[model samples]
Target: MSLGFAYAAGFVLATSTGMLTLLGSGEFPPWLWLALFAPSATAVMRARNRQAPGWLGTLIGGGALIYGTLVVQSQGASGVLIGSTSGLLGIFIARLVTRTTLKHDLQALMLSLLIVIAGAGMNSGVSYGISFVAYAVSVVWALVTRQLVEGAEREASLPFGATLEVTLARRDIVTPVFFAASAMVSLVVLLSTSFLFVLFPRVGLGSFKMAQNSGLPDSVSLRGSPMAGGSGAVVARVKGVSGTQIDRGLYLRAATYDRMTRDAFVRDSELVGLQRSEWARLAHHEDARQYDVFLQPVTDGHLLVLG
Candidate 1:
């Protein structure tokens, strides 16, 4: 029963990681949710009557990995997308290994670690931090339970096959004291890690920094300015406006589309390979005023700047 709990916790963590990755992507497709949930649901249903079929699980997992790879290839492999794909693959492998092996408690936990790593990679919001804490607590419970179960099996002096049938008394391991101790340990570890993270020095990457950018769409709408008078409704609210008494046209360039087709403006892919020095030269200004711009979420993931 403890082993079963551990497996269930691991599966839940993996699912949560996948969900967080999808949420971080800022665009969720219906099929992505289906792909995430279908295999786990099927595995649960199969576990009720008999052992999960290893071959079937492997097939499902392999299909998901392939599909995730295709998505990364087509979508330009952002950190969140990479993490999402890794979580999916981890889920598949966890399911396959758990169904195939009798001594799979440790294996499932290890596979769940992959999901945790993926979650770390994809995290951007406060919710992911909460999920991280939950995952950590679950892991502590799983590990403690697994240790108790293994100790009990070792003490019984039974054959390996007979040990599988050995049952542990709830009072022996699942007592209130045990839970409190585990929770305390988990909390201490969490606090220590957070403290260390806070103390770590942060460094910034300058113009040559490499980061993934979302692929550009063919056409973009050059809408009217947000500050225009007689607009229908306010699309965004700007704060911290002070000492601005100039009545002039303000243009914020989000992206440059150099290739125009019959119906849409496409990005010139060649421009991306330009050297840092070339870009610096092109962007040089004799008297450029620098100010921070805080933009709310938009459909496309492009940086908007005013020159």
Candidate 2:
């Protein structure tokens, strides 16, 4: 029960992010954000054992579905899809509150995934990326929590009590460490999968472009002027620095030219793998500055900033 609330809250956040991303991208109307309260209120009412009859939920859900379909015939398809998803979400919420099975939960999760996928397909902006990350983490956490407790909960069902009894782990099955460990695992999954996605060659998808567009040479020949073929467009965005730091400027070390001639310096074309690991002890200062860097897919070897 302790883990259940965490999972529920995370699930809500993931769904909210997906909805907001779609809304921000103009895929749906602004009022769609307010529709989240339907499921939320139903879940809370059920928790308090004061929920209305299942017929009420069905009526509302059916009405919503019919309205969304009418919307599809008259206007935007994106809005209709999202509206139908939200209606299904509420129906699943009712199922979850009224049953002891996992069918409804899985159905809701899938619908949430559909929303996120739609948003991703329509928008490649930072908001959609953030929505994806939040959805990924929440899905990971919810899966972990559900898998661990499903059997136990089924066995521990009661006749006169609620199925889920949620508390903040004051003296319960889940603790802060459990949440932290799940978050770390989610991070690992996100990083590994993202790296694999970027590293995979997508030549058929037409993602790769001519090196001249990136302002960098594809292979070193030392024949042409290295600086002559590049664009002056922005490649990356850095956050957490002040205006003063931006005014001072930054120097970037993008690549190394190990093989050089008198005419020009050359870098290796297929110089493969190198891996290194070391540990060092150093004095720490009270003040340290850290910032986040977001880079566009400009080159195989990404840009690096130096102090």
The parts of candidate 1 lying over 4 Å away from their true place are 1-28, 34-49, 77-80, 83-103, 156-166, 203-307
Q: Clash pairs of candidate 1?
A: none
Residues 109-198 of candidate 1: C-alpha lDDT, one tens digit per residue = 565566556555556677677766766766777677667667666756756533533444333436567667877888999888766665
- Tens-digit lDDT track for model 2 on 204-239? 222454642433544444333333228775666778
TM-score of 2: 0.53
Q: What TM-score does structure 1 among the candidates reach?
A: 0.52
Q: Which model scores highest in lDDT?
A: 2
* Number of clashes recorded per candidate: 0, 1
Q: TM-score each candidate.
A: 0.52, 0.53
